[model samples]
Target: MKKVLMGMAIASSLATMMFVPNQAQAAVEANIGATSNYLWRGVSQSADSASVSGGIDYSDDSGFYAGTWVGSLGDGNGAETDFYLGFGGESGDFGYDVGYILYHYADLDDGDFGEVYFNGSYADFSFGVAYTVNSQVDDGSLFDTGDIYYSVGYGFEVAKEYSVGLTYGYYDFDAGSDSDYGHLQVDISKGDFTFSVSRADEDSGDDDTKFVVSWGTTF
Candidate 1:
């Protein structure tokens, strides 16, 4: 499964390169940061611990972009690396993004997956859907493929350089019981540095709530 997804990713990249014009004019940017906890789809990825991450991104004037990011995930999971490519543009007050992302886990067998997503935003509100294209396990198997996630978020400025955001998401497994969760976040920015505090709700179990504080900067 990993081999097949890697091949498709390469083919897609090649196709983009063949059609995109003036690729050399693209803008490149890099960022590094640390998070109190690595969370994905409202679930913890770092065993409820802190994580350091970094990534570089390239964006063209034609709304095509690609990037790779990596985050540390302890508990013998090593690192989680993600490769993504997408195109996004705005139309009047609405914006749309479509993309594919592959999640790879270092030092872990049968732990890679791929997803395709589409997102749209109107003003300060956004909504999106993502579907699992393939998983580490073979296709056509329950819980391995055909899973879907839906999310909605809204953000607004509370004061100068301060903002608050709320998000809710639902994960519907193809084989297991569904899960739903929400997140609330507050952010403050000073120059290139941003501080954030976030709280997320767990879908099940006794530890139903989790909070994290983090600081990050971009260069």
Candidate 2:
């Protein structure tokens, strides 16, 4: 299962690279950051492990965007890597996002697949949802268990170079799944540095707390 996830991550990254939007008036940007734990849709991608993550992105003045991101993770059960491609746009105070992400790992089964996501933001609050599709498990049983995830967040400026945000997320899985996930997190930013902490709930495990400290700059 783990190896399969890793393969999906690689394939998704390559797919994004092979396909670029035909556009004019687009501006390119890049950013990189690190965190003690990598969390996705409220699940611990790094488990209790520490990791680093970064990505580069491009956007058009008319509101189209695409980007790739990578990360490293460890969760005791297996080591993990992630690659993702995302597109989004902003119109006035509202914005929307659509993207695909692949999860991969070594010492595990291998295959490629991804999740489709969409979300929108307005003012200090934003919300979004996602679905995991066609993921296969090592046992020859496809993780027919798909996922639906949603989140909401609010941000406030604290200083000339600092801001803070609070977010909440919920996840629901397909049948026979006793385990689900959710999280409430707070993030702080100063200049190009951002730090965050989240209290997570996993259906099958004790509630976990995760922390992230990162530095990023836009160019």
Candidate 3:
């Protein structure tokens, strides 16, 4: 499952750090959160239900970071677990990150997959892309790999401890899957709470506009 992989990834990150003693800054953190609706690329993963999640992350002064997250899906597939590791750093006003992430569904058949991603930001604008690579499913309809996701975002602080963010994303599915779609999301956050609204360009199939309320904290 994804949770299992995340645990493995965390352990691997720690092991790798052991060999680079001078570069290891050693910082571990944890996070917890709840969301009114769990949405992924404009689709509801929780069937429009609320879900809770928790995760731990390890980061060094250098740019290496690894983390895991597990959240209830509320659908028949049960919980979705994820693991990711990447390097990120800032240069003046620009920042960049490159990483690999794995998503696992413990109870769903052929639902485990992984992707390599790259993201960059300059000031308040950001762009990113992710490509699917390894997939556990072997069926003809693999439903994985060859899919790419592209996103552009802008964020700005409206006031102290308050911010607004807008993102537009497009998913390029593998050939023969006409399910490709694009979505735009707006989020307003203050402290630990956030309000988000999103709509997909496609009007057909579960593309209904969604409004979600969420809260999260890190320590």
Which number leads on lDDT? 3
Q: Write the per-residue lDDT of candidate 3 for residues 1-219, one digit (tens) a residue.
A: 221121111111111112111145778888888888776666566767888888888888788889888888765557888888888877788878888988888877667888888888788888888888887755333346787878888889999999888878887767445667788788888887888887776534557788888888879
User: RMSD for each model, in Å, please?
Assistant: 7.4, 5.9, 6.7
Clashes of each: 0, 9, 0
lDDT by residue (43-71, candidate 1, tens digit) is 55677677787887888878898888777
- Note the Cα lDDT for every prediction shown: 0.60, 0.57, 0.69
How good is model 1 by TM-score? 0.78
| Residue-level error in angstroms, candidate 3, position 23 | 11
* Tens digit of per-residue lDDT, candidate 2, span 1-219: 432121211111121222233246777766565555555544455654565656676666554566666667564444444555566666688867677766555545444446777767788777777677756554333333376666777879988888887777776656434655667777787875667676767654536665666554556
Candidates sorted by lDDT, descending order?
3, 1, 2
Q: Against the hidden true structure, what lDDT does model 3 obtain?
A: 0.69
TM-score-better candidate, 1 vs 3: 3
For model 2, what is the C-alpha lDDT against the true structure? 0.57
